[model samples]
Target: MRQRNKPWADDFLRENTHLVIPSPSEHRGKWQELFGNNNPIHVEVGTGKGQFIVGMARQYPDINFIGIELSKSVIVTAAEKVQDSDQKNILLIQENAENLNEIFMENEVSTIYLNFSDPWPKKRHAKRRLTFHTFLKRYETALSPKGELIFKTDNRGLFEYSLVSFSEYGMLLNEVSLDLHKDHDPENIMTEYEEKFSAKGQPIYRCKAVFRGE
Candidate 1:
């Protein structure tokens, strides 16, 4: 569901400009320099409300994290969460995932996370699915040679589709979990949607895919 426009959203983003990278294109290959360290960087696309990324940032201080959300209202909520904490490794960017190639250089990112992404259930909209080869190709270009893509979703159809898509794209898949919470992973950090849906007994699906050559 699309969030209602919050009138203060834009202002909140502007005020927290320090927490966001306004021109990501300019920082393409120099992202490590932006953080003033050469830590491995992980990006989360469609990071709604920021729970997953924020939690990861807190858990892993050795890695630099970036959360990209297309909606200003949505990203503002993530920024607010960061502001209330002492997490400095997290950076929020208001950008579309389609333009990821222009935002990061090849082999610059170590991991990309897609949590509860829009399933795009319609047959005609398959290309728009984050797990589609179109977006996966872009992810391949943006990721490091050894980078991995971690995806989680509650939609069974999308999960099944992604498994086939990953195989067709020559990706090595592992950690395939059809029912994530049933196994109870101590390291699993739930996203906002994951938390709510899992509470209602929605079986969450998760997997990790890496390029075969990489």
Candidate 2:
């Protein structure tokens, strides 16, 4: 059933023009060509089906948005959704978050979104959690000194563990909400996964954490 939805998803993306990315890999600095002018970049990891990043690009025309997802099939769906939106300021990339540091230059990204990352609930697999200290360090390296990380999840344990992890790393907690959908936070965005999970009567936990001054 889920696989059946892929075509429709791709079709929707094709119809939406706003979710298109001209070229995503032109920013390596090794290439003689610079892709876009110095626009503040915002990234969303695990952008399931493109609802969140594409919506943000449509809402904020000034800033640029990049949606990175590990699954090729999923990213293709996301790309299609973005294509339907016709947003020139957005880009879609098929890549894992762990290699993010290589794809982006230091201080290149202004903001990042970690939406419902895998919890890796098993004790033995704790290191694989997206919010783990190692991953956070990579994010710190990629982010600008003032860059912010907007993390949202339906898992309470992951949220709690992430809170401690951020604190231990000396990252500043700029904002947090136990129930994101109900909190009325102006900056909060509702993603495809977020809408589905919340529809199931789940509380959405979210927070903004940032690395301290350089």
Candidate 3:
């Protein structure tokens, strides 16, 4: 889906620099310092409108959350949501997921979330998928030795592809659910997309995988 251009996006980003961090790479490996605590850090790669991250921050006050989104117009809405939530543990980054290595160092992140990412349903565009080997490599470098990669999507094809990709990349699947909503996980935090899709009776697929270090 094409994002509608927001003419005030640039100004909004400038004014809310505290919420939407600028030059996030400079904080690599020192994210805990930014949060002013030793709490574990979690990142959401495709934080669409800040629902999941903000909700997670509210649920786990001890953990720090960073939301990475590429769209300036889209992230501005997320930034506004974060601002309204007034959660100090949450931050936003206007950047691409491909630069995860540059924004975080080895063993820096504890958990990474890929929620309702674009399926990129084409053989030629498979490399662009969030679960692609290249992105998995980046996640391995940034996540701690025991760090986890949790993924949720309504697209079965992407879920199957991700399970295969994770196995091929030597990642251990700790948990998987083909029908997450049916399982009734009380701790589950729903993203905007998740709520919208699950409301339509679509099965939500989820998995928690950990990288097997060398």
Candidate 4:
């Protein structure tokens, strides 16, 4: 679903300057300095509306969270949530995920999250998928030695595709779940899409992969 451009969103983002980081690449290797601690950094790609990242920040104050979203119209809503809340460990960046390696230094990130990413279901569009080999290679370059990528989605086709992709990429997979909500997880933080789809009895698929750096 394409998001309708909200002209006011740009204004909202401008007003909440502190909630989002400026010149994210400048602080690539110094991300901990931005948070004033050496805590592990966790980032979410395509963090729509920022519910999950904000919730995670609130729950785990010891870890730093960065939300990478490309759309100003979409990330503005996330910035507003950070502005209204007491979350100091979170910083939102309006940047493309393709430039993640340049935005953050190699082995600097501890974990990466891909929540309900665009499926790009067409066969010709396979390379556009977040879990595609090209993107996986980029992630491999940016992730720490033992860094892990956790992904969640309601799309079964995408989920299956991701499993095959990860395995072929030589990543170690764990905690595979085809029906996430069916098993009550106290530690689970629901994204906006997760809540919407789960309400309609949709089962969420989840998996975690560790890049072997092979």
Candidate 5:
């Protein structure tokens, strides 16, 4: 889906540098210092519209949440939500997921969330998928030794591909759900896309996996 250009996005980002975070790479491994706490850090790779991150931060006050989004137009909406939430535990970064290692050091992140990411369905674009092996390697490096990766999506093909990718990468699958909303998990924080799809009776697939250490 093409993003609609928001004319005021630049000004909004400039005014809310505190929430959107400028020069994120400079902070690198010192994220704990930036958050002013030693609490575990959880990241949402494509935090669309900030719903999931904000909801997660509200539910887990002790855990720090960082949202990475590449679009200036899309992230502006997320930054607005974060500012309105007034939650100290949530931060946003307008950065590409491919550069995850550049912004975080090994063992710096405790958990990574991939929620409703673009499937990049074309065979030629398979590498662009967030669950592709290359991205998995980046996540593995940045995550702690026992760090967990939670993924949710409405795309069956992408979910299957991710399962195969995770298996090939030697990651252990902790949990897999083909119909996430069937159980109506109270702890589950729904993203904007999740709500839209699930409301239309679409099945949501979710999985939690951890890297296998040598």
Candidate 6:
């Protein structure tokens, strides 16, 4: 992660922060207070440029949204977008998704969004992929009972691999679309990456996997 112009980026990250927790670990038990109500909290694992979560927050005011990005530079961009809008229900946190459980308690998150996550295509880096078992375990740990896991990607191999991984873990899938734009799902929202890659004639795969284990 690159160091951002703290003075320039400070205003963005501090915007709409009626209540801000300095540490991710502090959020482990108080997600409800952060949103000013007991609204269901949904998360986007890799919010690029913040379009998806920002749009979702506008569309669904009753639901709280938090975006986690590993790169501070990209998060600074997302923070800028949040500063541009009036979204009291949306927040961006800079952190790697691998340590997801550190910030959220078991069964705390109502939903999980994985948008165009890193493919890490090389054979040696398969475990680094967001869909890998290692990452999924952390997601499962943070997710609420029967919580939703919505994943979208333009890479076919990752989508296919995710499908098998979900099945292997005995997760239930509700909306499984190999091509999102073609499927016409009402609840579906297009992220920045989805829009970009699709404009170039690429197929966008999407699915919602729910945890059923107790």
Task: Report every candidate's CA lDDT.
Answer: 0.91, 0.79, 0.96, 0.91, 0.96, 0.82
- The residue ranges of model 5 lying beyond 4 angstroms of the native Cα positions read none
Better of 1 and 2 by TM-score: 1
What are the TM-scores, per candidate, against the unseen true structure? 0.98, 0.86, 0.99, 0.96, 0.99, 0.90
Model 4 off-target regions past 4 Å?
none
- lDDT tens readout by residue for model 3, 10-115: 9999998899999999999898998899999999999999999999999999999999999998899999999999999999999999999999999999999999
lDDT by residue (57-153, candidate 2, tens digit) is: 8788888788888765687777867767877777776677888887788778889999998898998998999889999998898888999998999
Summarize candidate 6's per-residue lDDT along 1-214 as a digit string, tens digits. 2345555555655653442234777878688887779999998998878889888998999999998887656787777777677788887777888778999999899999999988888989989989888888988988888788989999999899899988888888897887788777776678877888889989899888887786
TM-score of 2: 0.86
How many clashing residue pairs appear in each of the predictions shown? 1, 15, 0, 0, 0, 0
lDDT of residue 71 for candidate 3: 92
TM-score of 6: 0.90
Residue 104 C-alpha lDDT in model 4: 91
> What does each candidate score in C-alpha RMSD?
0.9, 3.8, 0.6, 1.1, 0.6, 2.5
Give per-residue CA lDDT, model 1, range 11-40, as digits (tens).
Answer: 777777878778889899998898889999
Q: Per-residue lDDT for 1-214 in model 5, tens only?
A: 7899999998888898889998999999999999999999999999989999999999999999999999998999999899999999999999999999999999999999999999999999999999999999999999999999999999999999999999999999999999999977789999999999999999999999999988
Task: Tell me how far the alpha carbon of residue 16 in candidate 5 is from the true structure, in angstroms, after superposition.
Answer: 0.9
Q: List where candidate 1 sits over 4 angstroms from the true fold.
A: none
What's the lDDT for residue 34 in model 3? 88
Q: What is the lDDT of candidate 4?
A: 0.91
